[model samples]
Target: MKEGPDIAQLGALIGDPARANMLTALMAGGALTASKLAAEAGVTVQTASSHLKKLESADLLIQRKQGRHRYFALADDDVGALLETMMGLAARRGLTRTRTGPKDPALRKARVCYNHLAGELGVALYDGLLASAMLDEVDGEPVLTEAGRERMMQFGIDLAALETQRRPLCRSCLDWSARRTHLAGSLGQTLLSRFESLGWARREAASRVVHFTERGETELLATFCRQDQNSHGNRSQRIMRDT
Candidate 1:
């Protein structure tokens, strides 16, 4: 018979606070160097390295070498999806709370998710797409509808070519801030790239926060009406007050 999964091993790896923080940082969808991760985890380099070794051994992370430096990222989207689910459960169980701080306004607007858009704008767009019958949720995955394909084609996405790729076309990634699912997968990445290509959004230097351009703001307002109306009004006001 096949061996059962090693529950204890998985549990032990994530049980450490430092390792948890490191994993969280990776979940933001970028490979980071040990030094950067160390700072993020609020630990010394030595301690972070030790934790990273453990996580790597657990098959939860992967490391790549670039010249002399080593960068670490999650093993795959599977790892990120698992972390997202865990975070969701944690929130449902009241094990964590939303962090409040002085954050960039643009970040609150939109940002990258591994390779796709995330944050309030991303989540709202996902919702709008579902509501508009552009996508359908099936067995935890988002499937593009016929209308979605046509719409994407008009938006300059080659739907047939995207399907030929090995990567998923549509996926749902949990949003850290909104605690909701956003678009992910190749389709998500394509949408983000298209937005950037159109000068709709730009990434902040040394941060994951994404800033929308004036043109982007107008385009998004015209495309996603609900988000446009809600973004700068009662919703933001409430978030500001609550935070």
Candidate 2:
């Protein structure tokens, strides 16, 4: 017996075209109905249901029931993190699809990796937090600094409440587009949520892109300004280029 995890099995499960598409759709951090997921996968409802069963059986997805409707989401943040990393790997290897559109740039700028921000802006945010000493690495794992705690509270994020969640308070997720690390875990989710609530950004309908208004983008860049990363240019340049 191979006394190790079954990578081949997991790969086979996710390797299917329809299954991969369904999983990718769930990456937007929304629970999707089977029919909706079927549309995303370009497969029939029966096929989507069968695929969903396999995903759920493998624990890659978790089922949710609302009234008579059944919805499904990624099992947890770990699964999301894995998928994001795999995407980065795919991009790095030039294994990406040839299809291109305007949405590609938007997705590469600011999109949701599960429930938190990702892409160039996401990399920028992570860089900012580290540059400002708001987040630090203790031993090997990332940890929030005292300043980060105070800052989150001031920004209306309840750190104490976040700590009570099942997942860690802070963790770094690899951004697929940027090939760099970005925030994840409860704190990451809260930050994204706060951005939406404060009108700093809005998730596009049926898409993962999170578009920030002109003013909102300004404030966001100002809030997480990275003084040391001068070579990366400034907020104005990034927004102009992305838009």
Candidate 3:
């Protein structure tokens, strides 16, 4: 009689090759039809139905109806974060699939983790913010500093409106590809959207890959790199005044 959580059962559900593949596809932060999931798993629709049933019953997935088709996605941000952490653990342990594709490098460079940017560029963004003291840690959680708010506002992000949303303003997510921590939460999502709107980057069609144009990459680098943070003396001056 186990009184604790049933981790073994959850492991069994996610350990299957087909189910794991299907779940990975949903990491792109899009709802996918059962048929599409089946294709991703390379299994028959009937088999996919059985797998999806187990996942849904365990509350690992949620269903959505669009038009005449039913789509499935990860239950929430927690689930996505868990999966990403697991992937990072696997990579750290040298347990990875041998068959790699052309898009692998691109994905490692920049991709969407659930809904926010992740990978090398994502890690860079997180690093830049921290190096610039734009974010501070409070009770182990990341908090947006006053300087961060100013910078974000100057970049055209509506902080006042975004703060009104129910979602958190800042969170740290583990980036599996880069094996580092990247930003997540309402703020992270908005920043990625801002990049797209500014034509700095674009998510690839039907894939998690994010492609930054040459100019966009250069701009992103200039913005997030620590060397460039020196130009922003206001933030440092303000911090000095407070300290």
Candidate 4:
């Protein structure tokens, strides 16, 4: 007979409702205390702690101790990616039967994934970069091109300075809502920070939704239009019309 599935056990660990809710909350890359997670999962602190122990044992989460309190987050990007994939599959399978539309306009526009942008704006930005030959997918990571380096500089991203940071510069993160890849990594973090600094985007209170300012919308349209003109001459018009 065929071998029993290696990942079957792992799948079972994530299949629990409490564990799944905890994972979903942690997907935003925040270190949450057990009490906070308990509230998010609609369970008691003791119950949430029990589930968290199981998840931590499975290497799906990591716990850190600060003073006397313990904080939990996903083990790493790998865990986050797996969770995002599961969410996508669940959505496709009609698990979200009651919620069939965008619940928040800000989420439909742009939002944070841990430290990077996600949603339609993020997806479109990624596509624009690819079309301009600034980035490419290699394995599961995003590899920046020489042209990409120049383009990023033009956008006021200090790529040379970012290289010194001890983190992956470019990674392709699967977007839970868009079902496509958006930029993640140190570069992605920097871009998000820059946007926030410029007042282009702001995080919602107690939510993962990210709101774009009026200036942000204007800037985004202008930047996208310029990239489109450069990439397709007049063909960009046709592409947008088709979409």
Instruction: Report, for every candidate in turn, its global Cα lDDT versus the true structure.
Output: 0.77, 0.87, 0.85, 0.76
Higher-lDDT candidate among 1 and 3?
Answer: 3
In model 3, what are the clashing residue pairs, if there are any? none
Tell me the lDDT of candidate 4.
Answer: 0.76
Candidates sorted on TM-score, descending:
2, 3, 4, 1
Count of steric clashes across candidates, in order: 0, 0, 0, 0
Q: Which sections of candidate 1 miss by over 4 Å?
A: 1-3, 97-99, 104-108, 224-243
lDDT by residue (1-243, candidate 4, tens digit) is 668766888988888888888888876668999999999899999999999999999888999999999999888767876776777677677777464356455565677787688876777667677777778778756799998898778878999888998777988877766677778888887888888888888888767778888889568545643564554324434432331
Q: What is the C-alpha lDDT profile of model 1 across 52-153, one tens digit per residue?
A: 998998789999999999999988777777776677678677887468555545555676655678777777677767765678899988899997788788
Q: All candidates' TM-scores?
A: 0.80, 0.93, 0.89, 0.83
lDDT of 3 at 63: 95
* lDDT of each residue in 1-243, candidate 2, tens digit only: 778999999999999999999999999999999999999999999999999999999999999999999999999999999999999999999999889999998898899999999987787887777778888977755799998888879888988888888899989888877777789999999999999999999999899999988888788878875456454335424533653
For lDDT, candidate 2 versus 3, the one ahead is: 2
Question: In angstroms, how far off is 208's CA in candidate 1?
Answer: 2.9
Lowest summed lDDT window (length 10), candidate 3 = 234-243
